[model samples]
Target: MWLLRPPGVYRPQPDTWLLVQALHDAGIPRGARVLDMCTGTGALAIAAAGVGAGHVTALDVSLRATLATRFNARVRGLPVRVERRDALTFRAARQFDVILANPPYVPSPQGDLPRSGPSRAWDAARDGRALLDPLCVNASGMLSSGGMLLIVHSAVCGVAPTVDLLHKVGLKAAVVARRTVPFGPVMNRRIPFLEEQGLITAGQRDEELVVIRGDRRDDQP
Candidate 1:
C-alpha cells in the first residue's frame, strides 16, 4: 500500500507487516468497529477498512502521523477516523470490536519517551515495555465483549510479561504469530546497549517479532 508519510511519521516495517498478517488471519467481522493505536501511517487502520470494518479509528500522538493517515485514507476513499491522541489515555464512548497496535517496543537508553521527533516511532524505555505494558493493561477495557486485541513487538521485550499482563487483566492471551528478522538500523545501532542490558546475546543479530492476541471471551459480563 502506498501511504503518504511525512518526515517524522514512521515507515511501515516488518513488525507492521507481521501485525497486518495477524489481523488478516484473525478475520475481521463485517462492520466491526476497529481501533488502531499508535497508528503511524494508518496501515493497520487501512487494512481493517479494506477488510470490511464499518468504522476504523486511527490514533497517533504525532501531528505528522495524523495528517499522513488522514491523507492516505482520504486518497483510498476508506472510512477512517484519524485522531491525534496518546494511546495510553485515549477513550471512546463505545468499546471496539478489534484493537490493533504496533507500538514502540525498541528498548532505549533513556527512561523517558521523546516528546517529539522520529524516535517516538520506535523508542520505548529501558525495558521496552513503556508502551507495551500499559497497552496490555488498558486494552481489555477498550475492547467489547468477545473483542480481540492484536499487538506486535520484539521478543526482546519479554513476550511472557505481555501475555501475563493480559491474562491478569481477564483476557485470554497468547502469542499467535512470530517472525525472526535481521536487526534494522535502529536495533543494529542499539546492539551494544541491548547487549549490556542483557536483552540480547552478545552475538545475536536478529530479533524475533511476535504478534500476541488477547481475546475478551464472550462469557465476560
Candidate 2:
C-alpha cells in the first residue's frame, strides 16, 4: 500500500508488516470497530478498513503522522478517522472490537520518552516498556467483550512481561507469531548500548520480533 510519509513520520517496516499479518490472521468480523494505536503511517488502520471494519480510528501523538495517515486513507477512499492523541491516555466513547498496536519498544538510553522528533517513533524508556506496560494494562478497558488485541514488539524487551500484564488484566494472551530479522539502522546503531543493557549479547546482530495476541473473554462485563 502506498503512503505519504512526512519527515519524522515512521516508515512502515518489518514490525509494521508483522502486526498487519497478525491482524489479518485474527479475522476481523464485518463491521467490527477497530482502533490502531501509535499508528505511524496509518498502515494498520488502512488495513483494518480494507478488511471490512465498520469504524476505524487511528491515533498517533505526532501531527505529521496523523496528517500522513489522513491523507493516505483519503487517497485510498478508506473511511479512517485519524486523531492526534497519545494512545496511553486516549479513551474512546465505545469499546473497540479489535485493537492493533505497533508501539515504540526500542530500548533507549534516555530516561524518559522523547516529547518530540523522529525518535519518538521508536524510542521507549530504558526497559522498553514505557508504552507496552501501560498499553497492556489499559487494553482490557478499551476492548469489548470477546475483542482481541494484536501488538508487535521485540523480544529484547521480554515477551513474557507483556503476556503477564495482559493476563493480569484478564486478557488471554500469548505470542502468536515470530520473525527473526537483522538489526535495522536504529537497532544496529544501538548495539553497544543494547549489549550494556543486557538487551542483546555482544555479537547478536539479529533480534526476534513477536506478535502477541490478547483476547478479551466473552464472559467479561
RMSD in angstroms, all models?
A: 0.7, 0.7
Model 2, span 52-149: residue lDDT tens: 99999999999999999999999999999999999878887889999999999999999899999899999999989999998999999999999999
lDDT of 1 by residue, 35-70 (tens): 999999999999999999999999999999999999
Model 1 off-target regions past 4 Å?
Answer: none
lDDT of each: 0.94, 0.94
Worst 10 residues of 2 by lDDT: 85-94
Per-residue lDDT, model 1, residue 136, is: 87
